[model samples]
Target: MTPESARALAEDYFNGGRPHPLDIGVYTFDAGYVAWPREPTPGDPTVLPDTVGGACIVIDRHTGEVSVRPLLPPELVAELWPDPTPR
Candidate 1:
């Protein structure tokens, strides 16, 4: 997703207006997809979505193309989330 679109989705769904990356949990950039945390921390007292998981924002870091929805599947998530080590 373009950074703006991802930021908007994060703002609308995750709360706190425009959120910093830390407001979510973990994130990864690979093959143009940004795996934004579906479970954003309740920084204040805003209601959160019932689904406790994550979503993928496909961002073309180079061209600025962006998209949301159709989050990454379980198998792909396994591939994305586990190996990064959060440096």
Candidate 2:
């Protein structure tokens, strides 16, 4: 994610401040399986190396906006936010 997007997510959640640096994202490839606790899991961003759900991301608390793209060019994201990050 871009620095700006990360900052936005941090401000939206985590008490309008920086998200805990250690709090990496949690997601899974097996969306079909029901999780007992419906939240980010311990095997976050590390379990499924071949799946994007295991990838790192920052999400806006209210909007649920997610950024998988890094601070680089990708045609789709660039269209939405012309300049995603502050170089």
Candidate 3:
């Protein structure tokens, strides 16, 4: 999604008259689903080309976009927030 749309989506979190005293930037998550091919067992009852749980969401920062699968790993979280330590 565009930056304007992203900004608008994030604005909801800014409500309640509570001051968000930080320079944290806003990100957009365009939702979608993704899957990869995989070999199946000979006698397996499950279907081939296993599908992942939970849909993907595009994290757009205007500069670029990255897809986040379920259970975002620490490395990705680090990329999202360089400074992880709470103030």
Candidate 4:
């Protein structure tokens, strides 16, 4: 899938039933996309309690399937797409 499509899927997954007011940010990689909740105001000291330790949303480029993984660096998460670690 294209980056745009992958980002859309990730955003949908990230925002679905999310209790935080933060917006979702997406990064594209060769394998697919990584999405996570981001602070609406960068450098703001206030933290959205619900966003803490939220899972990273991964969207497969080929299958377009969404998976939840522990919060990790976006690049590392992308490199480990289809991570073997049990969810």
The TM-scores of all predictions, comma-separated, are 0.36, 0.21, 0.25, 0.71
The top-ranked prediction according to lDDT is: 4
Greater lDDT among 1 and 2 belongs to 1
| TM-score-better candidate, 1 vs 3 | 1
- lDDT per residue for candidate 3 within 1-87, as digits (tens), equals 566554443343323254742222443233311211123344766655344442223344544344444334324443444332413
Per-prediction backbone clash count: 5, 0, 0, 0
* Candidate 4: residue 38 Cα off by (Å): 0.9
Using lDDT as the measure, name the better of candidate 3 and candidate 4: 4
lDDT of 2 by residue, 1-87 (tens): 344454545444433444443232332221111011122455775565432332223343335566543422223334434244535
Candidate 3 residues lying further than 4 Å off, grouped into runs, are 19-22, 27-75, 78-87
- The stretch of ten residues in a row with the least summed lDDT in candidate 3 is 30-39
Give the alpha-carbon lDDT of every model. Answer: 0.48, 0.35, 0.37, 0.74
Q: What digit string (tens of lDDT, one per residue) describes model 4 on residues 1-87?
A: 897887667666756666664567888887777888775664656655545675888877788888888888887787777764733
Would you give me the overall lDDT of model 1? 0.48
Which residue pairs of candidate 3 clash?
none
